[model samples]
Target chain A: MVELVVFVLMGGGALAGGVTVIKARNPVYSAMGLLGTLFAIAVLYVMQLAHFVAAVQVIVYAGAVLTLFLFVIMMVGVDKEEDVRETIPHQRRLALALGLIAIGIVVSLVARGRFAWVPVASAAADPQATNGTVQALAEPMFTDWVLAFEATALLLTIAAAGTIALASFRRPVADTAAERTGV
Target chain B: MIPPPEINWFALLPLLVLGLGAAAVLLVDVQMKPHPKWLVRMAAAVLLATAAGALLQGWWLRRLEAGETVGTPLPFSGFLIVDRYAIFGTLLLAAIALLGLGAGQRFIVSLGRRAAEAIALVLLSTSGFMLMLSTPQLVMMFLGLEIGSISLYVVAGFSRQERQSEEAAIKYFLLGSFASAIFIYGVALVYAATGSLQLFEQQELLSRVAFVKPGVLLIGLALLIVGLAFKVTAAPFHGWAPDVYQGAPAGMVGFMAAAAKVGGFAALARIMATAFEGYIETWATVVAGIAVLSMIVGSFLAVVQSDFRRLLAYSGVAHAGFILTGIVAGEAGIGSIWFYLAVYTVQLVGAYAVVAAVSGASSAGSPLASYAGLAKRQPMLAHALTVLLLGMAGIPLTSGFIAKFGVFQDAFRAGFGWLVVVALLASVVSFFIYLRVIVTMYMEEPLEDRVLVLTVPLRLVLWTTLAMTVVFGLFPVPLLRLTAISLPL
Candidate 1:
């Protein structure tokens, strides 16, 4: 009964947050809605006993990523109302139809009772259940997936260097000197 | 406690060399004064060395196979597979990077101080794609894709002074992230269905199980196709290609396009042929539908594009359709697909080299008018472009014809005769598009006295690509044999 109640509340909150993210005129409001949705999803993850994933979702996504989004929104100055004119012909209608089709497909599959909302537990104790803790995750990450782990370091370095290269412009020496002299 | 997975350093040498080269280039850039030419030369040397490493690995694998081998080696707990396929992909990616950087020298030099960063990003992107080609695990492939894609997003915006470049980067980033998310969702669904992330393990599990709930697995497969299709710029998912190609700096656009195609298609082929082999009947028809749509849409669209870069983007879509036709034949067409990709990428880079020379390297919006009287003003570039365009159009006595024939034959053998017929018609229409450009260059009078000068590196790229095109057209036996040898293990 507690699980049922929690699922209902979190799912409702997630839906509302997603709607607000789409409908809100202000960029900051949209970002806030996104944060709410993320938090609700994190709660859902926790309900699934994925505590590590839930914590990371809260910390990395709701905390860090949402904050970055807000910072960008503020820097870009979200005072003006966005232009809501449709650029492509029939884009909204097409999107609506496609969305309806996708939802229908999912609903029909669920109606057929072929799509399980929760994973079926095995007769034996689940290895993954015991290994859901941080230590178990870290063991495979450091051992079996070590190459990928090291490769992530390279990816991050490349991203850092690429960001600096794309964002920072080096003016000619003459321009720098002139600017320094208040020209 | 679980035992630690065994590491195979020899299998990973090519990627390691590339990573070290990227770091070395960045460090060298900081320590010494920035000379774009010197940095490009250094990057080229690094790429050449990396390619050499890949070749050495290939040679070693052949020796192993000859001496004694029951099955292909799976290194890193089956996260990576070392075989002729991976080596071929790595060597091709390295070569494409070298050619792209070589052709992009003036553009990098134009950046003044950020040349090293540009070079490093190219190497990093190449390594990412190389890793993607070598991996057998879905998550590892995703990481490789992200690594390559994030670098490309930045590279797209390298000309920061231009509004269009920034727009292109933002568009690419938002859509790319969405696609990646969809791909991961598919991965999660597949895991839910089969309880495995490794491709081979998933195959085994799938074949063993009756799959009481197949809807989720089918949806997962569709999502995988959608994500990969978006990357390869297949029709309906190809909205970003034209804008991004037209907006990105001309010198690097070829590399970006070629690298992404090589990696994305390599992964797609592997996943379809290896993991989803049991569901060939289900996927083959779906792939055929996409192929038909892409060909029709790409051909008609190419005929209408006034911008040369956008035309090439559309042509790329058409070529992707051709390759997908081969893929629809299942594993039998993997060799044909690789051959098509290898030959097409070389010609693509060569064609873009001409564009980079005609338009300034950093400039966007290469209107077809720029090529007016190209033959009169710059005869050699015009000739090179003529050959390249002919190759792209699949004219007789060019490598493109052989590639088209191979794929069509594969599709026909697989009972996709209707698709092959549609593809032939699309190819003919696409030929007209290429012909239009050729006519504009040769027949149309000069708009202005725009001096088209080819830099030495650009010259080297063009000559090599051209020579390869002609040689492969005349004698495809060697390349055909090589591609046949590179099947996924």
Candidate 2:
């Protein structure tokens, strides 16, 4: 009964947050709604004992991504009116059609067999169900996935260098001088 | 305490050389006042060394095979596979980078201050694609894809002064992220279905386990195809190609298009061969369908483009269709795909080098009017372009014809005779697109008598590609043998 209550509360919160993110007129409000949805998802992850994923969800999505969103909103001016008119004819209708198709696929598969929806072969492929922890993740990161881990360092370097190349003007000496003198 | 995975340093030589070489170039640029020419040489040397390393590794693999030893060295717990296919891809990508950078040398020089960053990004992107080509695991492939794609995104908008370049950057970035999301979601679904990230593991599980319903797996496969199709600029998902190719700095566009094709197709081919080999009946038809669509769409669109760059973009789509036809043959067509990719990418770079010379290196548009009577003034460049364009159009006595033949034959042998027929019709339609350019160059009167500056590196690229197209066309036996041996099978 307690689990059912918690599930209902979090699931309802998530759905409401998702609806608000799409429906809210204000950009900031939409970002907050997104945060609410992400937080609900994190809580749901925790309930499933995927604590590592939950923490990552909170830290990365709720914390970092949401902050970035708000910063952009601040810079771009959150007071501006957003145009919600359809740019393409029948776009909403098309979207609704696609959504219906996806829902139909899900419903039909679920109705066909529970195993059809469920990942049945996953059990035989990997029966290990260790609690989500740093050790569980770190082992693979340091050993098997070490190349990918190191490659991320290069990816970050590219990101930094690329930003510098893109944002910095061609004549840096003149630009820096102008900036320093407040010209 | 657990020990670390066994490392094979030699097997990873191509990646190490390219990545460190990129960092080294950046460091050298900042530490001292290096000449722009020196930087170009430095970049060229790095790519050449990478190609040499790949060659050495291929030789080593051959030796291993001769000894009847521990087969298919999956270094780093199968994260990287040291096989002939990976070696071939590594070698080909390195060569393409070298040729692309050489062809774009004038543009690099014109960058003036940001030359090192541009060079470093090329090397880094090549290394990323090399990693992508070699990896057997999905997570590693995604990592490599992002590493390659993010760098290319920045490079596309290198001419930030142009609104078109900025628009291209944003469009590629946004659309690319969607494709990546779709791809990773497919990976997640595949993992959910089989609880494995390794393609072969997924394959083994799929063959062993008879699911009550494999709807999830099928959907995952479809999603994977869609994602890769976007990368290779296949039709219906190729909206970004013409704009991005037209808007990007002319120098690097060739590398960008070719690198993505090389890496994307490598992953696509490997995944289809290994993981979904059990469901060939389903995927083969779908691939055939995509092939036909791309050919029809790309060919028809190419005939209408006024911009030379946009025409090349559409032609690339058509070529992508031709290559997809090879994929319909499954593992049997790996050699043909490589052959097609090799000839096509080289031709693309050569063609773009001409565009860069005629239009400014960093300019957006390559208007067809600029090429009006190109042969009157710049005969050598015009001739080189003629050969390359003929190669692309799959004319007789050109490398393109041989490549088209190899792929069509492969598809036909694989019961895709109808696809081959459609592809031939597309090929004929594509002939006119290139012919239009040739006519504009040879027959049309000059718009102006202004001389075009042809750089040494650009000349070198033209000569190399022209010779390659002609020589390979005439003596295809050597390349055919090499490609046959390069297969993962």
> Which candidate number has the best TM-score?
2
Question: After TM-score superposition, what is the CA distance of residue B456 in candidate 1 from its true location, in Å?
Answer: 0.2
Best by DockQ: 2
TM-score, one value per model: 0.83, 0.84
True contacts kept of 1: 0.56
lDDT of 2 by residue, B1-489 (tens): 657767778878999999999998899989985877789899889999999999898878878879955655787887888888999999889989999899889888878778889999999999988888898899888888889888999999998766788899999999998998999988888888889998878888989987789888888888889988999999878999999999999988989999999999988998998888888889999999989999999999999999999999999999999999999898999999999998899889889988888888888989999999999989997898999999999998999999999999999999998999999999999999999999999999989888898888888998999999999999888988988777763
Per-residue lDDT value at B85 in model 2: 91
* lDDT per model vs. reference: 0.89, 0.89
lDDT of 2: 0.89
Report the C-alpha displacement of residue B291, candidate 1, in angstroms.
Answer: 0.7
Local accuracy of candidate 2 as per-residue lDDT tens digits, A39-140: 998887766656688899999999999999999999999888767788999998999999999999889877877564333222223346545655678788
